[model samples]
Target: MRAFVAIVPPEPAHADLDAFVAPRRALDSPWRWTPAHLWHVTLAFMAEVPESGIDEMVEEVAVVADSCDPIPLRLKGAGMFPHAGDARVMWTDVRPTDPRGLGDLERLALRTRSACSRIGVPTAGGDYRPHLTLARSRRAVDATSWLDAMEAYSGPAWLAQEVTVFVSRANRSGRPHYEAEARLPLGRR
Candidate 1:
């Protein structure tokens, strides 16, 4: 199955982002916007894991979760990945700061990749920039209007208590439908 590890944004935060994107959804742009419930910060893309490897993947993910603490993350601002010059993904920034010290979400991503590495799957790649992906455009957008819209988009502060490993399946709509394969609680340690 196609899979990925991600930090699920708390519900209140999701609602906030939902309100932000609702109006923009009608802009007639060449981008596909993600459903509000699907908004999340991807920790690592685990790629395709056969059914036989799934059980072990779940076990490893639990270990990583137990070693982590719940993180307080606030969604803020907006930016396009790869810049507006050649934008593909449009996302909102997140500030993962709290619990006195340590970047819990960032470390969790590293540990997730590290755990998969031991099994020779090599999950670690890309600089970890925490953001909630809003849309993916086939063509670059005039982000100026979008950026201006974001200025008034406000969502509640959220506490992420768990990370989820999901199995994704592409459908006729060309959108990926996701199912939770495993959920690992944070601050278990």
Candidate 2:
């Protein structure tokens, strides 16, 4: 199964982003916007795992979650992968509102990835930048205008109290559908 660990933003935050993007959706572009229900800050992308490994993955993630405190995060600003001139992916930045939030999130991500590695799941290679992916373009698109439009967005802050392991399956339309397999609460929560 395809799986990943992520922090799903609360409904209010989603609503804030939805309101901001609603007006821009009509614009004709090569970008494929992500569905609102799929918005999440990915901590670790464990591309594939055997069904038997699911329990082990959950246990490892739960241990990491218990060791960390809840993080306060908000969606603000935007940028493109590679660059706006020839960008394939577009995302909104996820920032910690609290002074210690970034550090905490970083630690959480590191631990999550480590756990997946220990369980024999291959992890995504790259420095972890906390962001909620907004769209993807099949070919390089001029995302400068879209980036400019997203600059003014700053959504409501919410506590990320749990790390969820989501199973990804392709729908009939070939779009990925994420289902929460396990939700592990952080710290004492």
Candidate 3:
């Protein structure tokens, strides 16, 4: 299965970002805006996981969650993937509420990746910059203007209480949709 680990923000956070994106989505543009329901902050993208290995993966993730406490996070700022010069994906940063603190989400990503590594599946290799995807485009485009407008956006603060493994699939309309395969509460052994 094509799966990933993520934290789903609470309703207030969604409401905050929805207000920000709803207007921009109405305008005709090249970007294919993601529906509000699909918004998430990916911890690790495990592109391919064998069905037989799923149970073990979930167990490892549960262990990681027990060792990690619930984190206070806020969705803020904006940026593009593969640099803004020629960008294909746009997103809002997921960050700790405190200006200075241990990097909670980054550590979570590393632990998630480590768990998957133990399962013999390597996650997408890269330095983790936690962010919630907002939109995508087929071709690269200059997004400075969009970045400037979104740079100041800071959504509602929420507690990251649980982590989920999501199975990705394309719906009838060809839009990507995610289904939760496993959910584990943070700080629960």
TM-score of each: 0.88, 0.94, 0.92
lDDT of 3 by residue, 92-183 (tens): 99888775423877888899999899879779868888888999999999888888988889988789999988877778999877789898
Give the Cα-based TM-score of candidate 2 against the true structure: 0.94
lDDT, residue 133, candidate 1: 90
Q: Give per-residue CA lDDT, model 1, range 117-138, as digits (tens).
A: 7775566468878778999987
lDDT of 2 by residue, 1-189 (tens): 789999999899999998998777778888899989999999999778888898999999999999999999999999999899999999999999989999999999999999889879888869989999888999998889889988889999899999999987788999988789999999963
Assess each prediction's global lDDT (C-alpha) against the native.
0.79, 0.91, 0.86
Those runs of model 1 whose alpha carbons end farther than 4 Å from true positions after fitting are: 97-102, 169-176
Which candidate number would show the highest TM-score if scored against the true structure? 2
Weakest ten-residue segment in model 2 by summed lDDT = 22-31
Worst 10 residues of 1 by lDDT: 96-105
Candidate with top lDDT is 2
lDDT of 3: 0.86
lDDT, residue 91, candidate 3: 95
Residue 184 in model 2: lDDT: 91
Q: In model 2, which runs have C-alpha deviations exceeding 4 angstroms?
A: 169-176
